[model samples]
Target: MFSLSSSADAQVEPFKGERIDPDVTSGHLNHLTPDQQAAFNVFKDTLAKAQLYSPERPHPTHDEPTLLRFLRARRFDPQKAYKQFADAEAWRKKHNVDALYATFPVDEFERARRFYPRWTGRRDKNGLPVYVYRIASLSGPLQKELNTIPPERRYQRIVALYETMTRFVLRLCTHLPHRTEPTPISSVTTIIDLDQVSLPTLWQLRSHLQEASALATANYPETLSTIAVVNSPSFFPTVWSWIKPWFDEGTRRKVHVLGKDPGPTLRTLIDPKDLPKPYGGELDWKFEDEPALDDAAKAVISEMPKGPVVFENGEVRRPTPPDPADVSSGES
Candidate 1:
């Protein structure tokens, strides 16, 4: 009968940090004699490999002998090392630079309006056509708060807030249903281009839009609908082409430095008359026909039932009416 043989399995070792040989440390300058150090220094000078001695130096110099030897052993050139370090520092500085914010240019907006196809697409689920806006007004309070911060911090803060707002808008957009075609706002007789507005102005406009959207959602739930359009083939090409290259090199540079692309997902919209003109300018074309609000949009607005000013019983009553004394004092 063949005898069964048993063999013990080799034990596996658990992972530990990388092992560095003691000999490698021994080869470092800490092990060299004064004479060796001097000789190594000469070798380093001939090799042009400098060692960084202190933080104040900002670069490596041909001072430390052991460091020189260590560099030579690694085939490190001090001049090249210094250049590499400088390049790295430069890149870091560029990345750390703050983003610049400004209002959309009026000329650019006009150009976009002229060249880009007017969105004649279907309405979103709420029966409203895609809305477009220029930076109209910025929040004075927010602007004041931003101005108080240091320049380096201010741009970063604004960018962060902008991102937050963009996300919020996207969330709102997703909730709305898709429409076959956008319903034109008949009341909007003119499409004035206010592109020359400053960044602060745009920020203010965005603030107002956000506040209004939120209020409409809360108070007139039935009336307002939110929707986001990303890479909207219908509108993105027009908007992006019009705005991208028109920005000055400084603005583009800031965008690059900040690593922000403001890609297709950045396009946003708000409904009806929420985004009004900052200071009205004449539109190139006028809408001869007035468009009516769709049933879906009306339903949204209606959902947030307003407090009754007149009761069903034909009695005039005010819900949450202001006190006469408070109204007189202008404190209501």
Candidate 2:
């Protein structure tokens, strides 16, 4: 393969694995400095006082961890964080988000999953879940299929996928029995392939894309570990200008814009076996094919603890961490 020019190299920003100052990325429950600890205690108290949260929440993705996510997204300012927290709780109830995943039709869920980034069923070098999006493939049937769905259903697809990632994938990966990594795998590592995304396809996806971006930024808050944008065309800068405003600064910092060639940079963060073939790895998977399960995912089914998670919307989730050790490494 021929080498790319220095001009091309200039666009290739590498992934930095940044943590928000005061180190909130090291999971939400612990490792906060004394000052941070006090702020969290106050944050919890504020939620309790408002009665938005009755018992505060648990580690990983529940009330406790969610408080930390909101706090960090708001730059540790308790007041702004409180408003966001209040709004999110209200939004969840209004949308029935807690049970949206459980009751979302299996047929619809399977169909919708194809529209967004498909999880690789593997983890990155740091053991965070890995996802690959073949955006160039979003034309013809993919575009037509997506457009045909009712507007309400399309929006529900977004919420359902987010809920699945937060409640299901994060829970399993965080608790895998043999994982030696001390940090709970609360976030994800993403590879966004924009090799040949046409102008028409981009135009078509703009609304759904922007809405999903806004939703994640508002409610999910700080869940992205790293996003490596690969195989981008020369026009990417213009496209990015339109899309960049959707994410907050913290989220933007996690994006690595790798122009045209992505192999070298990708190898630095993801191993060959774990990464998919399209991204220059040996996994032997494709965008439309069934996802291949890695050992860790298989272990989730066979080795991890299980629990009955009954949502307020009357739907139940599986394996809701019996204890901290079950989901976290007990390091923090």
Candidate 3:
């Protein structure tokens, strides 16, 4: 590995994690007082000694602001944080996260985006990547493709996609300009638009939502700073009630339920200039834009490869015929 010169190191700014001050206004440990930092160190050291520790595993340094993200999520309770850290480490191994990251499934992500429409777009006011999931707009051939997967396999694939995509987004955060260590960048601000969601749609998603909540809370741990559920319908309270128990106190508190006009809440958390047009923000960025989905995703639904075919202008078009040579060679 190449080493940074002393001159290069000197230019590196001291992040909140490197300071003992409680007055730091930004970054991962911004909320941590000097006393809290001291207490957290004990927990961090304990976690490092746990059986799940792997020397080769990629993680932020012990003193890095990112490490404190998990600790802070557990309210600086070392034992609880250790369980989260250890479990996450084990889950990564079991899921072969390293391999997944190295070889990202571009086509699969393209397919998944059609169904989920969740994407990491521009940074929020705090510089956290904005995660938007248009829950009400689950259409296209990808929906059929996702449904075709057996429940058990679907669960695994969904979990893998969730974790993998999260890591990918966080990785992208590292490259954003004007970023400081830890604090906001370590967490994401999410908007789950529930407009047009029917009862049947809610029922179909119940299991996947449950598994996703459990996986995120247990494994990802404190990765979400905010979850603004906008455009919530009358039935949303019932749906929220069913899923509310899945979240921990910290997570539940982060969730903000809003009605059709979520502009005010979104404006308070995000700069109006950074907000999407639908949410009363000025950002020209649209969910269907490829940039919003990042490099891992393909073009918008219409331009994507046709598997089961998609509804175009309110009509379902016939699927394109498979390539004869590809079929003969048994290629996907």
Best by lDDT: 2
lDDT by residue (tens digit), candidate 1, 1-332: 00000111110111121221112122234555565556555545544533323423544432243243333333354454344434432432343311111222323322222111122122322333433322221235544554454654433333322222222222222223433112211110112223344444543444333333332222111111222211122332333333434322222221110011112111222232322222121112222211233344344332212212221122223233345474454331
**TM-score, every prediction:** 0.21, 0.81, 0.71
Stretches > 4 Å off in candidate 1: 1-146, 180-332
Q: Rate the local accuracy (lDDT) of all candidates.
A: 0.28, 0.65, 0.55
The TM-score leader among the candidates is 2
Q: Report the lDDT tens digits of candidate 3 across residue range 1-332.
A: 00001111111221112111111233255666776777677876786576343233363323244466667767777788787777776675566544443344556545555454354456666566676777656544545566787876555555545543444455445444434544435666777777788877877767656766676666656567666666767776566556656665555555555667777667766777768888878877665554343222222222322222322233334323445574455332
RMSD of 3: 13.7
User: Model 3, poorest ten-residue lDDT window?
Assistant: 1-10
lDDT for model 3 comes to: 0.55
Worst 10 residues of 2 by lDDT: 1-10
Regions of candidate 2 where Cα sits further than 4 Å from its true position: 1-27, 56-63, 177-182, 302-332
lDDT of 2 by residue, 1-332 (tens): 00011123233453233321122244356567677788887887897787666672442234465568788778778788899988887677666664565466666777777888777777776667778878867778888888898887788788877877776666666665423344455677777888778766777888878777777877777677777777777676666667766665566666677656566667767778977877778888887755576875664453222222222222224423224352243211
Ranking by lDDT: 2, 3, 1
Off by over 4 Å in 3: 1-27, 51-66, 139-142, 163-166, 178-184, 293-332
